[model samples]
Target: MTLTALFNKSIIVSGISFLLYFSSFLSPGNATSNNARLTSKDRVTTASPAVLVFSKTNGYRHKSIEAGKAAFTKMAADKNFTVEFTEDSTQFNTENLKRFKAVVFLNTTGNVLGDQEQAAFEKFIQAGGGYVGIHSATDCEYNWEWYGKLAGAYFLNHPGPKNVLNGKFYVVDKDHPTTKGMPAEFERSDEFYSFKNINPDINVLIKIDEKSYAGGKNGDNHPMSWYHDYDGGRAFYTAMGHTDESFVEPLFLNHVYAGLQYAIGK
Candidate 1:
């Protein structure tokens, strides 16, 4: 064959091959479902990395749970992550927890997890998973010594009348990423919690000025937000999400987001 003839023949053969490959998808036998076709060597799964938000409350449930969920969902979307909100403690298993990089206790109070679930979560943390606790998370699992340390404190009491709001947020560790971008001194209206058994090892990100509020039990250096590398994983806790309105506040929401990022090791 002449050089041009050979080249034309090759093109014809390539066209036939391309047509056949394209037609295969149009056939009924090549139907794609359940991500079967998407799970190939060159393709990654569509599932985004996610956080597991557990809001199960066995004690006084916070009404801001819904607001917390909404804010977390937005924050996850901003980072291209997903949020899985669950009230069922059964999801706290080795298999289920493996899907998430971190777990967020959004105002979860009292004994929410069973013995098995607790063990699974501990294993998850030991395996380098993460935890983010908000508001009443400190009020949870008082009998569980490890969890108390993870949450960094146990809730003692809030100010009198249960409405002594907008205490001065004094940045203690301003250089920490969790406190970065936050002002050195700003007032936020939250049902600020005084703490007991405050973990000495925790890196306090921010504290509340006791003199700025009514009930000041924790005294001068009352930590409101903190983070630490606990066990083999990361943990972040903030005691400021007590009201639904706090979720809408830009500073408070970003503070929580920063803590979330820190906890998830992002």
Candidate 2:
């Protein structure tokens, strides 16, 4: 063959070989392709559940809401749980809530939802969904009976005009998952809450020692955290997370983390 022709033929053979090799690599049966196969197990780490955070309230406690959001996001990223956050309670419609394994009320307060949305949320919980309430979540839905029952209490009062001091948190049920990694009694600086008509039957996980705070209501039995079963659904609530400082605390974060996981059914 001519030298020029030989060179051209050699170039064509090289090109064809390269294409064949690329095609093989791209095939699903190839080892490289198999390595990329994504599984549900691969997406989540601890078989943790999914959680949705709903914060739809307008008031002076915006900081608390923001802190709650940050905490939920952090947990969602590292744990086996997924999180969806929104300030619109209307998004709690049946279809939207069905996608989440659990729902969280992040420092929400007052009448944030309309009649239809309230009814939908009630139904959602009754259907064996999970719920997690943080901080001022107790101050929410004062007129909704179902919600009050689910939350286990309503905001009756606060000692400080605003949350500005450190308070002691007393663990009522240290054996609970939410308190499993926490100390029996720990003092932290945050806004403490007192509830009205807290359901006595609900499992109380943590309580605030009223003696530690001035002008505190509910006396010495003030509950700081609780969990209960409502209409076939699991519910958790913590009076903590009133400040940005609370979210970053290692011990507090662990408590919130376990609560979120439990509410997600993990």
Candidate 3:
């Protein structure tokens, strides 16, 4: 062959060899491409997803809000998720809500969001966002029918702050991710709320045994926690985190984590 032809042949050979080497270097047995050794089913995400915890209240605010914040913060660290805590109603815009996988309403009450803010949040949920409501989250946005439906219930009455009940919490749906491993029934002390306008579509996860506590208006099969899909989004609510101690309880934290995880599409 001519010198030029020979040189072109060498270039082709070198190119083929380099490709072979590169392919071998990135093989499934290798670790360079991150989790390369694991199959698709075995692989897991390491990047943390984000969630927003909004605790604004236009009416009665729970003093345990701080504790709830701390609990979620701790959960993020242990569960491989990121959390942003804010009490600012102005943060309910599209730009602010976009980054979150879920928005957690922690003991929020009354009409927390303004007209524009409410519209923005509605858009978020419509765009497949998620919501996790803690304790008195059901107490808010009485005038906003869309929000009331999203929350699944509205606060009616509780036996007052002074009448904390060590109520028997009946596990209604143990199959749900939120209450998957929880006991059949557990006693917890907190202000049990009787809800109004309870959305008929919600999947009840736990019910409070009304007989275990006084002033339990919704006598038989009264729901205390539930979840539902609403307006193209996922929602979970638990009326259990009423006391500061609730945040520290392992069972309670796990329950909340599972719900939040479910909302985030885990």
Candidate 4:
């Protein structure tokens, strides 16, 4: 070959080698990429989705709110997800709500969101956002009929003589991710709530054994935790988390995590 042709061939060969080397460097199995991967461990890991914890309440408020928030903040860090806690009603706007994979109502009570805010929230759910209601969240938005169905029930009453009581929890559906690893039967002491306007279609994950406690209103099938797909999004609600200690409980934390996962479409 002529000298000029040979030089051109060498250039082409050098370019091909360079491309191959670059490709290998980008491979996961490569050593140089390993250090780069370690530096970007967060990005290299699973996508860290975010959830918004909204504890707004116009009426009665639970003292566990702060504890729940703290626990959830820790949970977000440990589980590789982002959590933003807020009671501000303005956060309900579509633009703000879009940033969350799920919205968690932690111990919220009474009518919190206004008509416009409620509309935005409804739209958020319809757009495939997730919702997790803890404790008194069922007590909110009683006038908003759509929220009743979304929450699966409205808070009717609890044992008035004592807000906190002892009860035996029965796991009805062990197949659900939230209840999967939990014991079939367990005992817990907390403010158990009675529910009205409960949608019969909801899939109950856990129930309280009324016979184990006094002033049991719901009788044989008192649901403590349940989940269902509502509109275009997922909904999970639990009657627990009334006490500050409940937030620190390992099982309860796991339950919350699992509920979040389900709501986020994981």
Please, what is the TM-score per model? 0.84, 0.81, 0.83, 0.84
Show the lowest summed lDDT stretch of 10 residues, model 1: 40-49
1-266 per-residue lDDT for model 2 (tens digits) = 99999999999999999999998977878765567555544655434566788888865455757776777787777664678888886797989888777888888877888998987788888888888888888898888888888889988777656556777787888788788877778888877777897887789888888788775789867888888888878888888787788777888788877776676666
Clashing pairs in 1: 166-189
Residue by residue across 1-266, what tens digits does model 1's lDDT show? 89999999999999999999998887777766424565663243345568899999998988899988888888877877778999999999999999998999999988999999999999999999999999999999999999998889899988777664877888998787777788899997889888999889999889989888788798788899899999999999999889999898888888888887787777
Candidate 1 global TM-score:
0.84
- Which has the better TM-score: candidate 1, or candidate 2? 1
Candidate 4: C-alpha lDDT: 0.92
All-Cα superposition RMSD per candidate: 5.5, 4.7, 6.5, 6.2
Model 1 misses residue 206 by how many Å? 0.3
Best by lDDT: 4
TM-score of 3: 0.83
Name the weakest run of 10 consecutive residues (lDDT summed) in model 2. 38-47
lDDT of each: 0.87, 0.80, 0.89, 0.92
Best by TM-score: 4
Better of 1 and 3 by TM-score: 1
* lDDT, candidate 3, 1-266, per-residue tens: 99999999999999999999998867876764566445453434534688999999888878999999999888888987889999898999999899889999999988888999999999999999999999899999899999989989898899965668788989998898888788998998998999999999999999998888888888796999899999999999998888999999989999999998888878
The list of candidate 3 runs beyond 4 A from truth reads 1-47
